[model samples]
Target: MEKTRAILVDITKCIGCQSCEQACKQVHGFPMETEARLSPTALTVIEEHGDKFVRRMCMHCEDPACASACLVGALRKTATGPVTYDGAKCIGCRYCVVACPFSVPRYEWSKLAPLVKKCDMCAARQSAGQLPACVEACPTGASIVGWRDEILEEAERRILGDAKYVKHIYGSQEAGGTSVFFLSDVAFEKLGFAAAPQQPMPVLTANALGDVPTVVMVGGAVLSGIYWITQRRVAVADEERRER
Candidate 1:
C-alpha cells in the first residue's frame, strides 16, 4: 500500500542534457566539482551515443551485494526501498566499493579520511513527499522515481506498445532486479551499460558462500565416521591375532 522508493530512467527519452546530474549534486549539498566531477558528486550521468544519451546510476538492487559486503553495516536498504548509508558507522573499509555491481559507490580517495559516497535517491526530499532533484530537474521526464513494481510494469508496457524499443529492460534482471530500470532504443551495451550476465552478479557468489558451511559440516562428519570405522577394524584385527 506504500510507495517503495524507486527510480525509472528511460534512455530513449534522455536528450544528453546534464541537468539531471547537476541537480543531484546540487540537492545533495556535495562539494562543487568541475565537469570532471561528472563521475563523483553526480550520482547519475548521461553519455552520448550516436544521437541519444545513456544515463548511468546505481541500480539499487533488491538484493544488494554492497549491503551484504559491508562489514560495518554502513550500507543498508530501507523498507521505502532506498539504499542508504550511515557515515558515522563506516570504517571506510571499501567493501561496498568492491561489492557494487554497477560500480556506483565512489570513495573520497583524495581526502585524509576517505569516505564512500553514492546516491541515496534523495531520501530526505522523498520524505517530504517530493521527487528526487534529478527527477524534478529532468526537462523531458526522462527520469522519475516511484514504486519498483509499478515502474517495471510501466517499462514492460512501453516495450510492448513500442515496436522500435529493444525489448530488453536493462536493470530488470541484472543483479537480481534493481529498483532502477531502463528502456532503450539502441543496444544497451552501446550506451555503456555494463554487459551484465543473464543471472544476477551476486547470486553466483552468494551461492558459493551458502554452500561453504554445508560442505564443511558434511565433510567433517564423513571423516569422523571413517575414523571410527577404521578404529573398529583395527580392534577386530588385534583380537583375531590374540586368539590365533
Candidate 2:
C-alpha cells in the first residue's frame, strides 16, 4: 500500500549527452567524470549502443537479492523504493556483490576497509522531495522518476502509442519487478541487458543459505571434539613423562 518510487527510462529519448552520468558523479562527490563501468565512484553509467545510448544503474528490485544476501543487514529495500546501504552495518562479506542479478553492487577493492557500492536512487534527495540527480540533470526527458505503478502506466502508454517502441517493458517482470523500468526502441538484449528470471532472487538465495547455519553448527561441534581429544592426549603424555 505504501507508494514505492520508480524511474522510467526511455532509451529512445537519450541523446548520448552523458549529462545524467555527470550529475550522478557530482551528487556523490566523485571525480566528476563518467566511467566505463559502475564503480564505487560511479553509481550510474551511460553506455553507447551504436546511435543509441543506454543508462545502467541499480534496478532497485521489489525484493532485492543484495539485501537478502547481506549477513549483517547492510542492505535494505526501502518501502518508498531505493535499495539503500549502510556501511556501518556491513561486515565486508561481499555476498551482496555475488547475489545481485544485474551485477549492480560493486566492492571497494582498493581500500583496506572496503565498502559495497551501488545506486540507491538518491534516497536522500527523494526523502527531501527532490528528483534523483540523474533524472534532474537529463537535458532530454529520457529519464523520469515517480510512483512505480504510475511509471508502469506511462511506460505502457508510450509503448502502445508509438509503433517504434519495443513491446516489452524491460523491468516489469524481471526478477519479480524492479523499481526502475526501461522503454527502448531497440531490443533490450541488443542493448546489453541481461534477461533476468521472473522469480525473485531472494527466494533462491534464502533457500541456498538456509542450510549454511546448520552445516556450520555441525562442523563446529566436530572441530571442538577433535580439539578436546588432542589437548587431552597432550596432557596424558606430559603426566607419563613426569612419572618416569
Candidate 3:
C-alpha cells in the first residue's frame, strides 16, 4: 500500500491572520524571528499584498524537479508523497534551488555551511492521525491536508459550482501534478503566482539525460578505437623510416 499526501489550499478562504505561519513554527520547533525577515528554519510564511494576505510553503510535487536535479539524491519524494530532504547528503550545490518549479526550496545564505529547506507536509503528524500544523492553525480552513486526487477533484468541483472562482487550480497539473493544489477567488497572477508550464519541469531535462549511460559507453568505445588506430599508424610509419 503506497501512501499519497497532499495539501488543499483555498486561498479564497484565507483571511491573512498569520496563525498558520505561527503554528508551523511551533510544530516544527523552529526559532522565532521578527515578522518581516524569513529564515531557513521557517518553512511557512504569510505574504501581504495590498489589503490581502497570502500563505506560501512547499507544494511537494508528485515528481519534484528538485529531487530529479539532485545529483546525490539529497532531495527525494517519499512513499508518503511528501518531498523530503536529507541534510547529510546535501553538498550545498544549489541545483535544487534552480530546479524547483514552484520556487519552494529556500537556502540559508548567511551560514558558512548553508542548507536548503522546505515544508515536508508533516509526516510525523499524519502518522499520528493528526493534521499538519498549518492546516490545524488555519482559522478559515484555508489549508487542508489530504489525498492528492481528492483534493484536485474538490477544487474542480468548487470552481464548477461557483462562477466566482478564477477557474484555475494552481498546482493541479503544474510540475506534473503537485501534492498541493490552490484555489483562488482572484486571478493567481494577482496573488503573485507565476504562470506555470503544463509539462513537468524534470521531463525536459530527463529526456536528455536519459541517453547518458548509452552515450557514454558508445563514446568511450569509439574513442578507444581511434586511439588504437592512431598508435598503430605511428608504429607503421616508424618501421618504414627504419627500412629506408
Better-scoring candidate (lDDT), 1 or 3: 3
Q: Could you tell me every candidate's TM-score relative to the true structure? A: 0.83, 0.85, 0.90
**Candidate-wise lDDT, in order:** 0.81, 0.92, 0.83
lDDT of each residue in 12-55, candidate 1, tens digit only: 88887788887887887765563533355667777677898877
> What would the per-residue lDDT of candidate 2 be over residues 136-195, giving only the tens digit for each residue?
999889999999999999999999999999899998989999999999998899999988
Better candidate by lDDT, 1 or 2:
2
Candidate 3, residues 1-244, lDDT tens digits: the string is 6758789888778888888888888987777663543458778888776766677888888888899999999999889888889999999999998988677788999999998988888877887889888898888888887777777778889999998888888888677778888888887888887577777888888879989998999999999999999999999999999999
In what order do the candidates fall by TM-score, top score first?
A: 3, 2, 1
Off by over 4 Å in 1: 1-3, 32-38, 211-244
Q: In candidate 3, which residue ranges exceed 4 Å CA deviation? A: 1-3, 239-244
Top candidate by TM-score: 3
RMSD per model, one decimal: 3.1, 5.8, 2.1
Q: Which candidate ranks first by lDDT, i.e. highest? A: 2
- Which pairs of residues collide in model 3? none
